[model samples]
Target: MRSVFVTGTDTGVGKTVVAGGLAGGLASMGYSVGVMKPVATGGILINGEITSSDLLFLQAAIGNTALDEKALSMPYCLKTPAAPAIA
Candidate 1:
């Protein structure tokens, strides 16, 4: 039951990429990986619906676990390109 926490020095620092890569690698090694973003700043528009690309990548990496998006991501998402507090 080993776990790892991935954090970033600042926003847009490729945390998502690193996390997804780790999860994908772990899953390939026969580990049941779970990903949690907790908080995110940017909003990705998909098929006329606003979603988080980070979460989507995580789901793809982990083979789409039963966890819902709300449980994986934060509630508030900012539309601007800046930080959530500023956007």
Candidate 2:
């Protein structure tokens, strides 16, 4: 199986866009694509739970909800709009 690790120069630098696009492209080529952000910051509180928009995009691209969005993508969520360590 092939894998990819996508990182950015800094936060909010279109990392999600690039990652999602790559997953979509791979899926279209008949490959099983999985995306994991590992850590996210600046999560919005919805219904008393933290969530990030990037994870949502990744879920949509993969077309599966069995993969835990929080566990698979956002293991750590920071409230402030900054780095995880800083926020």
Candidate 3:
């Protein structure tokens, strides 16, 4: 099992895009991928669920495969766009 982590000083950077690209690349090479976020503050309401678009893109890049048990757990959800510490 291999893993990569991407972090930055601010939001709206290329974290999601880069992660998705890496996942896509790995998936193209026939490796299964799992995407996760420990805490995400803001997200869109999709199908009655608050979902992070960043995560959505990452998951899509990895394809619609069944995620493992840990990845199936819910994320820390917040309603505002502010930092998690204050949200």
lDDT score, candidate 3, position 22:
88
TM-score of each: 0.73, 0.79, 0.79
Q: How large is the C-alpha RMSD of every model relative to the true structure?
A: 2.8, 2.2, 2.8
Candidate 3 Cα misplacement greater than 4 A, ranges: 65-74
TM-score of 3: 0.79
Compose the digit string of candidate 1's lDDT tens values, residues 1-87.
788999878778888899999999999999988777766556687656556777788878988834346544546555456774565
How many clashes show up in model 2?
Answer: 0
- Per-model clash counts, in order, read 0, 0, 0
The lDDT per prediction is 0.73, 0.76, 0.70
**What's the candidate order when arranged by decreasing lDDT?**
2, 1, 3
lDDT of 3 by residue, 1-87 (tens): 887887876777877788888889999899977777667778677657676666677777887533332235236656578864577
**Model 2 lDDT tens row, 1-87:** 777888877776888899898888888798888778777777788667787777878878877554345775678776667874476
Give candidate 1's TM-score: 0.73
Question: What shift in Å separates residue 70 of candidate 3 from its native position after superposition?
Answer: 9.8
Q: After superposition, how far is residue 32 of candidate 2 from its true place, in Å?
A: 1.2
Span of 10 residues, lowest total lDDT, candidate 2: 64-73
- lDDT-better candidate, 2 vs 3: 2
